[model samples]
Target: MAQIGMEQIGVVERVWRYPIKSVGGESLRQADVDERGLVGDRVYAVRDARGKLGSGKNSRRFTRMDGLLHLSSRLLSDADEPVLLDVDGTAVPDANGFLRSYLNQDDVELAREGEISHFDELPVSVLTTATLDWVRAAVPDVPVDERRFRPNLLVRTPPGCPPFLEDGWPGRAARIGNVRLTFVRSCVRCVMVNADQPTLPHSSDVLRTIAAGHDNCLGTLATVAAPGAITVGDTVALESQDAL
Candidate 1:
């Protein structure tokens, strides 16, 4: 039965998990939600000699390594073994060996998540179609996609939902299918959103369009309050704490 105070904000349009960071992500019809967002998400990442992780942008925790976006990884088993793939979708036999050649660097290892979490801020990132609509209206000449935002959960709002609807979700809770999430804050995007993926051309205009009016924040971030499972077409119902 639906709760009296719950508001149905949207339906889950898509689910994604990037087994390897800064690389292409795998989409699924359903996914298991856990404390780390998704069961196999970001469990593996390419690391360099200096101990910085591979990413499209350079930072203390990440090193700007070109061509990482041209690659992706898929968890082959429950053990969390990742199968590296090229942009053409061919799986590489030797993961590390392929990384050396593809990235043109040595001392690179496809390492697993250590004590420090691989996520940029929160465990999960969420985006709504309403926000994408805003981006489309802002820069109709360029392309704007949820893949560019790299959200773990993509919510599909109704036709008239305003843009950035998730902005007001902080300090609130939402039930997405069997999973429960606590909204943390708006996701502050970085240069990685502008990186080229398999079919996406590299373009600065996407991020530029966001920064000009939205303070470089696009989606929202959250933590799994009740770990479970979610599927495409699942209803996302919000529970406002302030009203409770």
Candidate 2:
């Protein structure tokens, strides 16, 4: 048998779920894992009047997409109903309010899709604390918050392990207990990273820093290979199938 080495790093300190795209995300103490991904995850998205999906890409023209911010459920609580909040103290309960507050134009025409809220083209997104720290050092001017990256899983690993090294781990698999997830591609970031969480102003050089160091491909995207629940303290093990 060939010897395989695995390193156990820090635990998942937080779990965030963006119920609706560009609207806001809810933080959770714990979440159920399924084949599709995390339960109540990107299950809702914002759509324009034409029934087309709206994202920071095209919606950047409107400051709402850039000005407003959303976080995961893990960061919020039920007492804070209408979980989505803006920098100006405005809050919304459901999609309707979110559209109104964000779009700004009363007749912009918007709706929320409840059936499926997919993010770009990936099933799961992951990031690391070390990577964020590295980028912050590269560009002292940019404030790189996890909310900006909007990742599903944020793993904290050793200092020098490439931030998005998961890119090279493609075809291999990682396990958090019985749950297994396959690393796919790197997550491509956008102006959303520059947008302030509680303010409307935009910051530059955020993506530039990422491109400089961690642009291994884009960002980190993954998919669930086996269904099981994951938590903050769960230990993750990365294993290559060829060794088996």
Name the best candidate (by lDDT): 1
Residue ranges of candidate 2 with Cα displaced over 4 Å? 1-10, 59-64, 70-83, 86-94, 107-117, 159-162, 199-201, 216-218, 241-244
lDDT of 1 by residue, 1-244 (tens): 5578789999999999899988888898889888778999988889999889998888889898898878877776554587889878899889899899888897898998999888889889899999988987987776768888889999999999999899999989999988999998999989987888777778898888889989999989999999999999999999867653
Q: Give one digit per residue, the lDDT tens place, for model 2 in 5-39.
A: 55454457666777656655665656678987877
Query: For all the candidates, what are their Cα RMSDs to the real structure?
Result: 1.4, 4.4
Q: Per-residue lDDT for 150 in model 2?
A: 78
What is candidate 1's TM-score against the reference? 0.96
Q: Cα RMSD (Å) between model 1 and the true structure? A: 1.4
Cα lDDT listed for each candidate: 0.87, 0.61
TM-scores for every predicted model? 0.96, 0.78
